[model samples]
Target chain A: MTVATSDRAPAPAAPDGASRPTPRAPRRRPRRGTVARYAVLCLMVVLLAGPLLWQLSLSLKGAGDTLYERPPRLIPTDPTLTNFTDVLDRVPVLRYVGNSALVALMAVVGNIVGATLAGYALARLRFRGRGIATGVFVAALLVPIETVIVSQFLVVRSLGLTDTLLGVVLPGAVAALNVLLMRNAFAGLPDELEEAAVIDGANAWQRFLRICVPQVTGVITVVAIFAFVGAWNDFLWPLIVLSSEESYTLTVGLNRLRGTFYDDPRLIAAGTVIALIPIITFFVLLQRFFFRGLESGGIKG
Target chain B: MSSSTDLAVRERAAAPRRPRAAGARATHRWRFVPWLMLLPGLAVVITFIVLPFGNTLRLAFTDATLLRPGRWVGLENFERLLGDDRFLTALLNSSLYVVCVVPFMMLLPLVLATLVSRPGRLMGFFRTSIYMPVVMSSVVVGLIWTSMLDRRGLVNETLATFGAIAEPVPFLTDRWLLLFSAMFVTVWMGLGYYMVIYLAALANIDGTLYDAAAMDGAGVVRTFLSVTMPGVRSTMALIGVLSSVAAFRVFGEVYVLTGGTGGVGGRNLTMTMLIQREGTGLQAQTGYAGAISLVMFVVLGALLVVQLWLQQREGRTR
Candidate 1:
């Protein structure tokens, strides 16, 4: 429907399917079919994002507001932050936040470093069992984590890492899919630059770190974002590994909030909203990179 | 993300063989460098995924508990599975999920992708907002729906207000309804994620095909059938495989909706839910869980193989 501006900006067939508008594309009325399309889009949005917004509205409602009125209120007439404060006071919201943040940070850094190094080596350097190494990662990719989870927990327990953040971050630290993505990114680059660097007496490490890594920073960002989101959003793994309340991530802690106080919808809404804040902010700021990296990476559909 | 993941491995499989013997970089000293660089990632993957899976297979044949590693029990656990009523319900629920969810996942996202294909601010807004649910934790998604589907909650209240129904629908308590509700949530969360993949695949579609369709006076429906369908056939098949496997192994939505008890009488339990319930915790009967996991692994593996075979067959038939 927004294709109304296609005349002015001339919508380029970007790899991401023309989502990003060309610069200075002035606003214009939608073409004929675009109107009906926009109506459908709006309805879909209401069906989709409407729930989250409703939750946000409920979170903002004050103690005076009756939650289940005959005609429900979409907006809080007297908006207040008491629900947020109430959830925070009731649970270790900050600790859970910090724990979730730490897990996300670790997963991001680990995937970027680990996936990048292995990806570069696999793509740029040839060695024994290269096919086997690639195969291993591919095989790992096929194994549903759900299937191996119990034994993974046993592995963690054996390593004395259960109930710890490290265990939660380990299995996903170097996700196989990210490694293959990085490998594909590295492989897509022309060999001329690395070949020149090699002839110039630059070692493999130098060629990789100085020449190759720079070209694939985009994929690295993609990996980081995926890892961060995966870690932040993960529920089952951390739930299985970490039993102690102190080690609980935001998702787990929020589930506790729901279990303990199912009556207080406002408080639960506030907790979920609090959990959503950092990730949404992060996504909004870096979504350009997120989609762009995805486009250039030519991620498998 | 899983839709992309299954395709990732398949693409790797089909990727052109890597050329070797590049330059001075192939020296003996550099021989170990690739291995060294690969060590950390490989170590993590092997330790956590590969080795544990091996242990799982081993444990599946044993009567291991959390405390003591018992001796081999061979087909005992598998035999127990035959009589386990919860296991049967879990299998049935998981099968129902795959049947209900996969087709919607394949078709809906492609439509969504086509709808927002053109570039503009509003389109981008739709894209980002639709994809937002994908980024959210399943727990958050589950909780949000749980609140909405409550007895006197948003859905029932709205329905009653509209004079649609007389009594509140038992979404959370009833077993069958809960499974269907979980399926709805699965499709809801998955739409934009697969829509993005469909967007990528849609972009790969040749524009000249659309032009050709138009030149022939092809209607919208005709154009879609002749142009878009063939173009994204493989992607659709890939989505079919990914969504089916994911649907079969569903855990988070059912877990959150049923509040970790797997619904009233645990009739809504999924394969993953069954594994989590039986395989984990202090009194964990890991042997039985391992048997359940082995079955899950094989079922999923068979799913992948069958889909791939079907895709290949369709290609040859075309």
Candidate 2:
């Protein structure tokens, strides 16, 4: 799966002198740069897309086609979408999608509300215990989610939220990293605006919503996309929390495609591709925002 | 302006007296504002993340098996770890992975960012194409690569056609190849992410630096070395830390690639895998897994501190 760090490439900048063919080319190129660039690009295509394409081929192939006598064809000879239909029929695919969507939505909302409020306070308010809260968060970064799984499970179960969408979403609604990112974004905004709003009889909430929130829409977009991707692609927590088959998310559901459609690799690949399509689109759409967010974050933070 | 100045003077005049009289009331009322706003997040962090971490630490110290009550074993778990060959192997494998992947991931992104930063007409397309894999989950990546590395997969088929080898290379089964394959997949997955990070840093770099360098007739490579590289030094350090952390935590690819065995003869069992295997593998030795995890946590902590120190030093030097 795509790691979070990679998805946040800096947005392309508007080039100065868009038409200038500067004389710097000869200085940089040793002939190998071109060769190396092509080589890397070719390698990138192969390495990045190879598995995805292979999965597609295998998924479409008929039974016993995995080790085809002829070298594996890129496309299936029969070219059937049967695997997709088969996966749809064999298991509770819709239910799994619903569960994943519900959990992810809740996670997004929860993270936004919790992280935004915390970020605002940390950014604007001067209060006691701020230092301690910040320290707690930074410390939380070192604590692997896996290390706390059992404890979280216990706590969720005790709270009666376990095995439900709320259970899985609530625990992860806020994270230290999100807080840090949001704080960075908020800190960059001019403080004068908030003070002006306060002077104009705007309450704290109003000023934050109208003034601070708009100023940091870029960061908010980044956070929302991150939460969505994280919740959607999440595996371990969902695996632990959602015991019922009906509560399965896409990641778990796709994994089930392996056993249910045992002989059919097409079904699995189709399932993977289907799952990946949305995620890839999401990344592309937000690529511009994600890059800007990271770039500003690095400098200001 | 006079009114504002008067108010400021009044506030300045009143500041000393108000602190003694209104300080108690103001402090009490304002103190809760930040805390109140922060409570919800704090609750989640403590309940889910923090408590769970504590549980892991506690669990590590006890002789607990799955579904069994743990007995306090103090340093025994830590003591047993000193002799854990598998732990040692996983540690070595993870180190090797970090060592190899970090430089490649770091440099490739720097290069790719440079290339795409000013990509003439194809900038958007090239950037998007490069970043396509940045959104997919690791599960999908693992599944995809497994399909490719299969015996009759594309790489081998191409090799066979070119007569590059007498036989198809067993990519997943062979130990070194398996590691390489996993590393390759990891780097591919990682490149676009860091590329974006670097791209962002590059955007912030004052274009005038390049202009200045060019005015001085400095070569592209020289400008890059003297200007761009130094300009993005802090960002590079940040990425280095992040990349190292990721490398040290290598698990998912190995788990999916070799199905948690780390390929033939446990050649690829990373510490995370070892801990996971002990916890849920056929053995299900939670205590031992917890112990392995504790060792790993220490390793991670030590490595992170050292990395931070190195970066701080580099920052100062720059």
Candidate 3:
């Protein structure tokens, strides 16, 4: 969701030095405001979460259930996992899941290893041309994926890797944003620990691995989550790169279900639920890190 | 909102100014270790991102295809685009998308941020539930809305049941409605994401201002207009720039909603969709697609430039 125009606009950076007589008055608000706020929040929840839950309900509905009820029943008439199994029987969703997992795994590992090494290099191990390397990455941040997406496909095709999972992973393996993000993390670290290690005859690699990497695991986790979510949820690049049915990721494959089961909304709903479950589970488990990164402006969409 | 973090990273990138580097950075190290570390990262970025961008530009000028590398046909692709109705529709659709969608994005998210900014246990649940849509894939988001907006889908059925409409609206089948429906989806998925950004900016505003406003006997609306608006003025502008840029580049919503046909008569294509439609396949017109991509990139860049110009002017005024 973030573009590389990295500078956010002005924030109120005033000093909190006013010695006012009212020393932090009790935080209370009018009842009318609270009531109106809750009313709005409830509407928002219904608007945002309603569609997802509706899909879930539709997916769980039995074959005998009516989908086009005028008021649209919130609960399934006969909840069952038949739609999920039917989706599996109709489409090779497990295979697509495997494809998505492979792409995401490669992206995660590649970003963690590649970004960490380069970030440590840029931040700690000073050398010539460092500025140029950093500039190259900063420039990469400004190039929107939409612009380079087709050219990237052309590049992959030229390499004879089109329609392959590796092709899907190649363009995103070490995203420049993650590299720069990792670099920022390393640069923020205090030099006291690493300096002592350097004096004690530890090499650059050791300093990076034993000391620097562990400390920035917070950012590493952020990178990993973003990479996984991005790789899993990405629709456009994979849609372009992989043409064969066998190479389809979950996202690209789910669209195929629409053509195959256009008449059966239940089946399509089941496919979407299947596509959503893993990411939803991921958010449920790692929501702390996700929200933490979000609030601190660490993760990109 | 994450852009603020980049402000810090940019400061660090300025080099020699960061005091934390004074110690270990000087002690340095092995001769080739740094380059060796950078080799993989730099290689991947240049090969995949940077160099491909150059190729996209180069291909924009040539009559290239997937099979054979054709001769350079300078300006032919762009020139043809002047007469290309698909190109024009795409440009208009994307431009109109930015215009229609950005206002909602600017207002809804800020209101959401203000509501959820208060402290309570339920606030956490509200925030997370609202944000759930942001993490869902565009494929899923599109499917959800597509089903909901189907002729017999929930939205139409409910509208009919409530006597709001005598017939089902052609949300997916009609070109104009498809574009508008896609914009709605864009704003829906993006609402929580921007609200979180605004939450951070709202946090930065001093609590004392609200207190002072209350002490001045101002009502809720008065306090909001005077204190809250000015406090998040720059954030509103930033969201304006971000949302417009994202809206202009929109692909997934319209693509998936129309099931990749670009709606009825293929009149609903966004810029990125146009690029994809023209750029892919064995007989794909790489040149024309590249031209579309170039135009989209230039527009996005212009959006950011306008934002920066506005920020600078606001800074001057302040």
Clashes of each: 0, 14, 1
For A1-301, candidate 2 gives per-residue lDDT tens digits of 1223123222222355354333344434434444454455556666666677677676666653544544446766666667777767877777777887888888888778888889987876555566898888878866766555555665676687756888878878997788877777777887556655655556556667888888887777777777887898777666666767877888767655655654545666777777777777777767776566555553211
By DockQ, rank the candidates, best first.
Answer: 1, 3, 2
Clashes in predicted model 2 = 14
Give fnat for candidates 1, 2 and onward, in order.
0.51, 0.38, 0.60
Estimated TM-score for each candidate: 0.90, 0.84, 0.90
Model 3 chain A: weakest 10-residue lDDT segment is A1-10
Question: Which model scores highest in DockQ?
Answer: 1
* Model 1, runs deviating above 4 Å: A1-32, A293-301, B1-30, B215-217, B310-318
What is candidate 1's CA lDDT for residue A125?
Answer: 71
lDDT of 3 at B139: 91
Kindly report, for each predicted structure in the order presented, the TM-score of its chain A compared with the true chain A. 0.87, 0.85, 0.88
The TM-score of candidate 2's chain A against the true chain A comes to 0.85
Which portions of model 2 miss their true places by more than 4 Å? A1-23, A26-43, A57-72, A75-77, A157-162, A259-262, A298-301, B1-24, B27-31, B66-69, B119-121, B204-234, B260-267, B280-286, B314-318
